[model samples]
Target: MNWKKSLRAAGLVTALTFSLVGCNTEGSYSPQEIIDHALQETKEPLTYYGEYTMDMGEAGGKAQVKEWSKDGKRRIETISENGEHNIAVNNGSQIIMYDVVKNTVHKIDISKDGLDDFPSQRDQLEILFNTVKDTHDVKIAGEEKIAGRDTYKIVAKAKKNDTLIGDIEVWVDKKTWVTLKTITNSAGNKMTTEYTKLDDSAKIDDAQFTIDIPKDAKVEEISVPESESVKLDTVKEQLGEFLMVPEENGLTLDGISLDKGIEDRSEYTFNYSKNGQQNISVTVFKANSNANKVEPVFGEKEMDIRGQKGSVMDENKFRSISWQENGYQYSIFIGNSELTIEDLVTYAKQMTIVK
Candidate 1:
């Protein structure tokens, strides 16, 4: 495992822990008192709607989603050329994913309720009232300006047993206790989360949390894949595009060559132009490896070029990372490359994913 990525993820997770504590701690109030207040707030139901853009590390660019929610769960709907999909999730447990493309449904088991489940933005505000237990050192680093509003900066240190996450920094609204920015460095990748549109209040409905499973929807169990190494010739055959071998650290880089089909998919694929900066690679995995005679490709890991951490999709097995910026998104799968760290990051920065 990449300690940097693990540490960075720990940092982000620590920030989340503090965010939950902040919600439990009212202005100049005790953490326990704040949580009591938050529990009371949950009695009233609410919802919200907004636009969300997720920045997927080296995968490149941003993933845009129009959000809608009701009850206590939040769902994000994304439409790809294949079909529409919805990801319904709450922090630790209660994760529901729907793939209209394949017409599939998946659920997860969680020990506790996570903020990711809340349908209302107000729920985020209310969580500040709950528990204030920290296994490590935590401090309020004063305040900063976020979207014209004053926010409190909270920093946390690493714990002895905490190996995956190192440090975390969070920017929370001083007035509303809402998280304006969250930065986490885990597994070698640095992840940042920012929330906006607080000043504007809108109407949210209950239907957002409801899942009307299509009559034809297929039920499937989703889990991380376990695959070792990559085969060059097989990758070339799986991916419909021609691949060119790029040079880096004396290791061979297998990637998709620019072609007509790739050019055609560029529009719906999001941003493909700016990706020239990073060496781009592609891999095609068997969609139904568990049932049919299919081969799965486990992407390789390289060192970070921009000081960002490497990621573990499934405990260093079948994993992928994405990066988004300037209205574009790019994703690189490890099963697509066989280059060393220096060479991989050099080209990973050039790819993009758009839609």
Candidate 2:
């Protein structure tokens, strides 16, 4: 055999072997397929432990270490900030928040019925994920290298003419198909979530979702709305015309009632929900078409609540402006006068009127 001929044959064999290996190991996935796979991987309830820096608008910056666990039925979160650890354990319908600093614990029943909390947590997650999955058009935008890791970028938009969730984008890992980042926009406000140094290796304990209140700490259980005295029938009849319900369950209209109507006066009331949190208010009107700015009988105090900066009024006339802060403008103006801006906030938090 000629040595040169033999060398050429060996080279040919090597090239053929290389080609076979490439074919065997090459990944076959379209961008959309990759995104779908990634989203599926993230569907399972996960527990994550991480450090975060939050930019709270105007309240300044906050640095906290947090642990969050989601099982199909419940969620458990613990946040450490300012040398204090606050633990919140929620099972969809019930929330137990323990404030280490105050050494007090508050429990809120989110459950409509007395059921295990875990299922409630899981159900909420399912609803949120499904909203992102079904209501929007999801697509793989492209591939990019972020922080040295190859990732698939997926963008989402509300199906045509859908005004709710406007747009969203997600980044998925090429190797694991795990979502590395997500961005959501409703109207124009945007929310971005990025996962860094994620470890799927940790085994989450089921007990984390349950909290045992400390014996020495004070335990306070408060109903979300505290139930107001109002005629549900009258509120439905009066305010039903002005109220528009949200398609999303995250926000709801509730507790439409009328307080005692003053002589020659009409009082109306209503309420709304945001992310399972309730706010309500009532309006006592003199039955007069009024000015935009009404004088407060009492003084107004400055305060911030639910991410809104506003004034609080203490007065004889109780008029309310209840608003929902769900990345949109929602407000109800009820009354003929005597309530100040502060009274508006009271209405925002107290009246439960929805048709």
The numbered model that scores best in lDDT is: 2
Estimate every model's Cα lDDT from 0 to 1: 0.42, 0.45
What are the per-residue Cα lDDT tens digits for candidate 1 across 277-335? 33334432222223332122222233342345443232222234433333223344343
Clashes of each: 69, 26
The deviation in Å at residue 114 for candidate 1 is 11
Off by over 4 Å in 1: 1-47, 56-62, 65-70, 78-85, 89-95, 107-137, 157-163, 211-216, 221-355
Q: Write down the lDDT that model 2 would get.
A: 0.45
TM-score of each: 0.41, 0.43
Lowest summed lDDT across 10 adjacent residues in model 1 is found at 266-275
